[model samples]
Target: MAPVTNGRVLFNAIPEDYPVPGKTVVYDTTETIDFENVPLNGGILIKVLLLSLDPYMRGRLRAPEIESYMPAFPLGEPLTGGGIGVVLRSENDAVKAGTHVRGWLAHQQYYIAPNLSMLEVIDRDSKLDWSVYIGAAGMPGETAFAGWREYSEAKKGEVAFITTGAGPVGSMVIQIAKQDGVKVIASAGSEEKVKFMREIGADVVFNYKTTDVREVLKKEGPIDIYWDNVGGDTLDAAMEFAAKHSRFIECGQISGYNQGYQPMKNPGLIFAKCMHFHGFLLAVLRPKHSAAFQAEVVPKLVSGEYKFTEDISHGLDKVGDVLLAIQKGTNKGKAIVRVADE
Candidate 1:
């Protein structure tokens, strides 16, 4: 109804270590997006509702010269990643005002979606919350599905260990394992997260903050699968007692994302344990495996069989701070910023 002045977070500089708000992740306002004007020739204007703050985003905070699976966030550009948005105005027949969408959107109050192909116009009739698309029901959920089902091939009655167990992906791994009758040992940084892991059906949970990770893991684990999220000493311990022919799903390594690559103290166990360690991209399995993930997990979520929690901070201005908290592993659940109301 009125002209919209969008506010967005910009990738100001590459952080040498953890992101420093206003320095590495700067908050800046931008020119108002004219609702009457079409973006990307015939694209739509969207009002971002919820912004997903994920661990993978930390990798993009690096300097541009360094190469990774995805390109580093370019200097002085608006930061972009997965976000939940609502169409404000549309130029295409397929999209219209008031439609909910999930896609790669800037950490801004409003942005232009140049292509609907990169986005999924969510079924408005569904009872699911818009924020769910950015968290467990989104990429992280798909990651858990592919990691445990397609990659790990873990069987019932097997023992598995998941690091950073309170986070979305790791939590899903715990639920999926239990659903398939596998025993899961979950580890997290704090007492609160440890409790969350247990609530989400982790058979055994450990607080890495207090426990000797190596000793505890070696004692509780002859683990058949290690769904790794944090890499460093935790990985070393998983390696030490890995069961024969065990699968190690190398997921997000949050511990090393901010700090430079920290080598494992006992990488030699890869050979001695005969473990299958492979990294994977969930994007590779999109559309095909997406349905299976929804069909399998969404019902459980709705039925309260699969419990989850979300930590939402209000406003678009806090995008940088939330990302910082996610990097530090302080957010108890899915770290998200609610930018606008749906």
Candidate 2:
């Protein structure tokens, strides 16, 4: 009978470099929703519990005219990304009230999903936390799994190098490589992150900020597999020291996402070494590898054999700040915004 506050994080402007919290993205609470009276139209009304803020979202903040893999964020609208929520009302038989769902959701406190095809119904009684679905057990986890399983084919005892190694995807990459007996050399931005990489089983870990990445690679490398997340100078260095017939998984280029395209100093090394360099989209790979990833990884996650670090901040207002932190590689592990407690 009463209207409830429905807060939202809206995209306000296209940033020249990094998005500015409260300016480029604004938190608006002026909107109100009649929760009980809202129309579902053969779908569901959800109370958003959590939202995943990954590095890939940075590319979505550009002008609508600019074409890319994912569509640009429409100005003055709620930003959308991978999130988990609880359904309060449903008009569809497949989805019922009180069920938990995971999918791409608008960055708002509450939303009405008119379509159920993309949204997945998750068990509400699962032991894993809701936030995990948006991070280690979700898209980021899948990306890391696919990258290592399909792209990086380093044999046991061979060295594998992973950039941005403490974050969600890289952390998974590190653990997967270790499980297969591959020696992992990983880099992070801070000492804390370097420590985290070691804890996750990276054989050789270093704070790329303090130690020269190029020098470290030269000593620890001639790497058989290079899983690159930050692709500017670090990638250039990896190319220089990469072993003959090395496999390079070009996952993300967060280092230059805000600064624009960064040219490689020696891309010719790929040809000279007869290396395998591949860039993949998770959307393309998930259909092929998701079932296996879930079956193999989820059990390990539950048993505590595999670890995932989550950097969580609360409130809808924090979405902009979290995304900015992700782009700069400042947040630890998988950065998530806890919108509401489940």
Per-structure clash totals for the candidates: 0, 0
Residue lDDT tens for model 2, 1-342: 899999999999888999887788999999999989877777789999999998888899999999998899999999998899999999988888889999979999999998787799986326688888887888988999998899777688999999888989999999989989999999999999999899989989999889998888888888999998988888888888999999999998988889897899987888999999899999899999999987999888888898989999999999989988998878877899999996
For 253-291, candidate 1 gives per-residue lDDT tens digits of 777887776798876777787878988888876656787
How many clashes would you count in candidate 1? 0
Q: Work out candidate 2's RMSD over C-alphas.
A: 1.2
Model 1 regions more than 4 Å off: 38-40, 124-127
Candidate number of the best lDDT: 2
Residue 296, candidate 1: Cα error in Å is: 1.0
Candidate 2 residue 191 C-alpha distance from true site, Å: 0.6
Error of 2 at 207 (Å): 0.5
